[model samples]
Target chain A: AQSVAQPEDQVNVAEGNPLTVKCTYSVSGNPYLFWYVQYPNRGLQFLLKYITGDNLVKGSYGFEAEFNKSQTSFHLKKPSALVSDSALYFCAVNYGGSYIPTFGRGTSLIVHP
Target chain B: DTAVSQTPKYLVTQMGNDKSIKCEQNLGHDTMYWYKQDSKKFLKIMFSYNNKELIINETVPNRFSPKSPDKAHLNLHINSLELGDSAVYFCASSQAQTRNEQFFGPGTRLTVL
Candidate 1:
């Protein structure tokens, strides 16, 4: 069984500052990792994914995530934060041949302008 | 065009009433999924269907049943609605062999009183 853990319940950052949301996972085989964002009263939107190759993956709205295989972590990052960037973030993981991805409990990001 | 969409963005009903949420995807993806987001913003996968075939079925209650009429549509029906069932339900789709980044709908907020 695969599992995802987002240790933080909330993260606070100021506009123009770099932001990071931590995520870790446990899987039996090669893991497929992904990040998603959800605005208030909205569904999640895909941010980025790490299937193979480069450890660093860039995604929509200048968001990116780094897949650290040894650490079993995939952390989301952004060069600069904006007030509009505040939202709920989720981390999910799936292993080989598994159609189901286990999701984290989510971390709420608050970007103060 | 919306890549994924769900009907009845908000549902308010009393306990014991049955309801259903419908989802559709226009991205021609081969897989669809249903997820429940609880009050704490935790996302739990309820079911997944690939090519209209049942693929992933989580430990969801028996009252919750998912049906896929086709590869593009997946509907969730909840019987014996309970207050514990009140949560935001999301529908997502992805192509299995592709990058597998899920596209999500706006979500349906179900409220049982």
Candidate 2:
């Protein structure tokens, strides 16, 4: 079975400051990791994904994630944060060869002005 | 146009009643999925369909059923709804059964009283 873990329940960052939301995964085979954001009463929006390529994967809204195989982590990062970036973020992973994807409890991101 | 869209963005019903949620995607994707987001914000996959064919079914209760009328539409019908079923149900679509990014709809807030 595949699983995802988000250690942080919430992450606080100031506007224009760097921000990160942590994520880790456990899968039997290789992993296809993804990051999504959800605003209140909204659906999950895709941010980025890691299939097989550079360890650093860039995504929408100037967001990116570093895929660390050894750490089993895919941490979402943004060089400069914006108040509009405040939302709930979730980390997801599906087995390399399966259609089942598991998501973690979302981490609330608070971007202060 | 919205890549994925769901109808009845909000639903409120009493327990033991039956309700349904409709979903559609215009991204020309072959796979559609239904995900549930609990009150605590833990999202999990409930079912998946590929080109109108059932492909992945999670350990969901029998009361919760999914129907894919075609490649572009997937509907969820919950019978004898319970309070535990009160959550946001999301519909999503992807290009393939695996190794593809999922586009999600705005989600339907189902409040089973």
Candidate 3:
């Protein structure tokens, strides 16, 4: 079974400061990792995904994540945080054997101006 | 145009009642999935259909059934719902079974009293 973990339930950052939301996972085979963001009372929006190529993948809204094979970590990062960036972020993984994506408990990000 | 859409943004009913949530995607994707997000914001996949055929069915109980009448539409019907069934249900669609990036519809919040 594939499982993803987000250690922090919430993360707080100030505007103009860099922010990082950590995620880790375990899978039986090659893993497909993804990041998604959800606003209040809304559906999740796609952020980025890592399938096979580079370790760093850039996505919408100037966000990026780095996939570390040795550490089994895929952390979401942004150079600067904005108040509008506050939302619930989720990490998901799909084990190579199955196409179903398993999601982790989301992390609530709060950006202060 | 809306990529994915779900009806009855809010649903409240008694524990023993039956309810249905309809979903449609205009993205012309082949695979659609239903996922439940609990109060704690943990998301779990319940079912997935591809090309109007059942593809992935998780350990969900028999009371919850998903019907895909066509590729563009997938609806979920719950029978004999319980308090534990109260959660936010999101419908998402992707290009294919192997695609990880999914476009999600506004979730339907089901509150079973």
Candidate 4:
């Protein structure tokens, strides 16, 4: 069985500061990881995914995630934060063979202006 | 156009009642999935269908059923609804071969009283 873990329930950052939302996964073989963001009462929007290429994956809204095979982590990062960037973020993982993707408990990002 | 869509953005019903949420995807994807997001923002996959065939069925209660009439449509039906079933249900679709990125529909919020 595949699983994902998000250690933080919420992450706070100030505007113009860097932010990181942590995520880790346990899966057999290689994994396909994804990040999604959801605003209040809205559906999730895809941010980015790591399949098999470079460890650094860039995504929408200037967001990026670093895939660390050794750490079993895919942490979403942004060089700078904005109040509008505050939202619920989810990390998902799926082994290459399965059609099902397991999502982590979301991390609420709160950016103070 | 909405790549994925769900009907009845919000549903409020009494316990023991039966309700259904309909989902559709216009992305021409081969796979569709149903996920439940609890108050804590933990997401769990309930069911998945590929080409109208059940592919992934999680350990969900027997009262919760999913039907996929075609490749583009997947509906969730809950019988004898309970308070514990109150949550947001999301429908998503992705191409089966790659299955890297999934497009999500605005979730259906089910509130059982």
Best candidate, DockQ-wise? Answer: 2
Residue-wise C-alpha lDDT for candidate 2, range B10-97, written one tens digit per residue: 9999999999999999999988899998889888789988854675564799898888778899999999999999999999999775
TM-score of candidate 4 against the unseen true structure: 0.96
Tens-digit lDDT string for candidate 1 (B47-111): 88886368656479899998888888999999999999999999999887534888899999999
Write candidate 3's Cα lDDT for B40-72 as tens digits. 888888887886457656579988888988899
- Residue B89, model 3: lDDT of 99
- The TM-score each candidate achieves on chain A is 0.98, 0.97, 0.98, 0.98
Candidate RMSDs in Å, in order, are 1.4, 1.5, 1.4, 1.3
Q: Positional deviation of A23 in candidate 2, in angstroms?
A: 0.9
Q: State the TM-score, rounded to 2 decimals, of chain A in model 2.
A: 0.97
Q: Kindly give the stretch of ten consecutive residues in candidate 1 chain B with the minimal lDDT sum.
A: B50-59
Q: After superposition, how far is residue B97 of candidate 3 from its true place, in Å?
A: 3.6
DockQ of the two-chain complex in candidate 3: 0.71
Task: List candidate 1 segments past 4 Å from native.
Answer: B56-58
Q: What DockQ class does candidate 2 belong to?
A: medium
Q: Chain A TM-score of model 3 versus the true structure? A: 0.98
Q: Encode model 2's per-residue lDDT on A24-61: one tens digit a residue.
A: 99999888999999988888889999989899999999
Off by over 4 Å in 2: B52-58
Give the Cα error of residue B111 in candidate 3, in Å.
1.6
Q: Give a tens-digit lDDT track for model 4, residues A1-113.
A: 78999999999999999999999999987899999999999889999999998999999999999999999999999999999999999999998778888889899999999
